[model samples]
Target: MRYIVLFLHLILFSIGNAQQLAGHVYDKNTQKPIEGANVYLDGTTLGTMTNKDGYFAITAKNKMPNALVFSFIGYETITVEDPFSYDKNFKVLMKEDLIGLEEVVIGSPLFSRKKMLAAFKGQFLGTSKSASSCKILNENDIVLHYDPDNHVLSASAENPLRIVNNYLDYDIIFDLSDFGVKYNFNTLEPL
Candidate 1:
């Protein structure tokens, strides 16, 4: 009799602890559904992506107050706090990041293509073990610029940045929608 009572209590406890968070992601400016946006519980591995209709449903075992983080490339990340406090259905709006620039110009004299490649090589590929074997397959597709006044290095590509990391054994194709690297103008040091 005691075992039966304990089993029932466990089941009821589990049910009470489980929470379902459902929501749709939309663009704040366009009011359009944002598909492929990642939705995840803050500080937990539980995550899912928005479907074609920008709808997502996540089951969280932790009933304690937690935030949900929504992120997508080229858009600002949004966090909803105390998600469990709200009803099951909710909506999230993400704004596009406009401050990111596609290109930059440094001072009056421009850095030659060779100089730009040399400067960016170490910073982009890194000097770590995994970066040693990395290679950029299509160098010509990348356009690089530097702004001396603002001390910023920005890049844009006609196509995605394709790279192969031998040490990590991964091929990464990065979309350069808006990317920038900041540096100190006086010392020409990375910031």
Candidate 2:
């Protein structure tokens, strides 16, 4: 009978079979949906492409979690799993990789200028501000030899920070500004 056959098919299909997952992929940088992107498991043949609308849906034959690798030209590759990070369909969010930074070194140095250079060097070597054993000069040392070009003793021995001459100037101005008042002062010495 037709009813019997249909019922039998339904019973067999319900025997712990697979389910389809559905969702969309988006580009975080352009704030637009990405279409026609490739989504697939790392070591398996299971995969699909985003629709014209950046939507996707696919069922995993296996009930296990799978690493889905998504890729598109001009964008970073996206890897995703189901809500539980396995063999299930789910939405994915991808971010752009930033490629630039702006850096500016301000002011000069003090204590032979080379000492200030040593301080900056210290920062790179995991030296704490309160470190007592910091070696500025020793068997393996950094010396502050006078640079004729810049008149500052530095590792380069030339072209010292101009702020060195105005060290007290910066301090005087900053200290006065802390009073919630603005008064011009010429030097670090009390006027």
Candidate 3:
């Protein structure tokens, strides 16, 4: 009888601790499903993407997450805090950002498109010996901007940036979602 009660308690504990979260993502204006939107728990690798119908499901254990982060290119990022407080089947509406160029402008007097590209190459390609042989094939596709008020430099790509790394003998393609660097206004130093 004691063994039976212990086994029952273990089963009950396991069942109680397991949690499954399910949801759908949609366009706020169109009210249509948004496929391929990234949905994940903030600060954790636990994540999944929306399917063709914009539906997603994820499992968690023990405790509920503090927040869930939803992100996609050309769309605003949405963060849902205390997600477990909401209904099991929830709908998230993501707003589209139509103006990519205006959003990431470089306003510093000392920096131009040419200078921005040079700086980007140095930082992204790295200064290591192997990085010397790396080259960005489609450098023109990258757009750079600097916000004077915030002292921030931001970049985005119209398409995937292609790179030929001869040192590593690898061809790389990158789809940039977000890229930004904060700088000290007075010192012009990266922060």
Candidate 4:
């Protein structure tokens, strides 16, 4: 009887540990439910979209230290660190991202568009076997800028950058918020 009781307790503990992390996302200003919001554990493929009512639930297998990221188009991304420590169902408020819509005007670039594009591709997509098979579907949507003084190459796109990874057999829609690569000024090599 003692052994059976102990076994049952262990099973119950395991079941409790498998409980999911759930939450609702809403707009800070409008207080309306945000549908189609991206909820994911940062750096992991475990992701899900919010329902029409702004409810989202993702399996929390273990006590993860990763940040829980909430993102959507035209909204400021929110990151909650140590999500496992919070209540099972919490509320997330997302603010509007107004700056993303502002137009950026650039003067004459030091390098040609073609050259800048090549550099951007090489740095963004690495020089690996699998990277060769990957292609950016919406290259035209990206805007590349090189700051000579800072020795940095930056890329921005209003729409999500579409990527087709033939090697991995995956179509990725990446919402690029920020991207910049620093290089050695003298040798023109990535730092």
Report the C-alpha lDDT of model 1 over 1-191, residue by residue, as the tens digit. 99999999999998898889998999999989999999998888889999998999999776756688899998999888988888879788899987655545445645677777766777777777878889999888888777767877767786998999888899989876666778766323444
- Model 3 per-residue lDDT at 117: 72
Q: After superposition, how far is residue 44 of candidate 3 from its true place, in Å?
A: 2.6
Rank all candidate structures by their lDDT, best first, as comma-separated numbers.
Answer: 4, 1, 3, 2
| Model 1 residue 190 lDDT score | 42
Best by the TM-score measure = 1
The stretch of ten residues in a row with the least summed lDDT in candidate 3 is: 100-109
TM-score of predicted structure 3:
0.52
- Tell me the TM-score of each prediction against the true structure: 0.56, 0.41, 0.52, 0.48
The lDDT for every candidate, in the order shown, is 0.82, 0.52, 0.80, 0.86
Candidate 3 backbone collisions, by pair: 105-145, 105-146, 106-145, 106-146
**What lDDT is reached at residue 140 by model 2?**
30
The model with the greatest lDDT is 4
lDDT of candidate 4 over 1-191, digit per residue (tens):
99999999998898788858898999999989999999999988888999999999999667778899999998999999988888979799999998634456568767777887877778888878888888999999988877888887888887999999989899989997788888777223555
Error of 2 at 106 (Å): 24
Which runs of model 4 end up more than 4 angstroms from their true locations?
1-13, 100-191
Q: Which ten residues in a row have the lowest lDDT in candidate 4?
A: 182-191
Model 1 spans with C-alpha error above 4 angstroms: 1-9, 102-140, 144-191
What is the Cα-based TM-score of model 4? 0.48
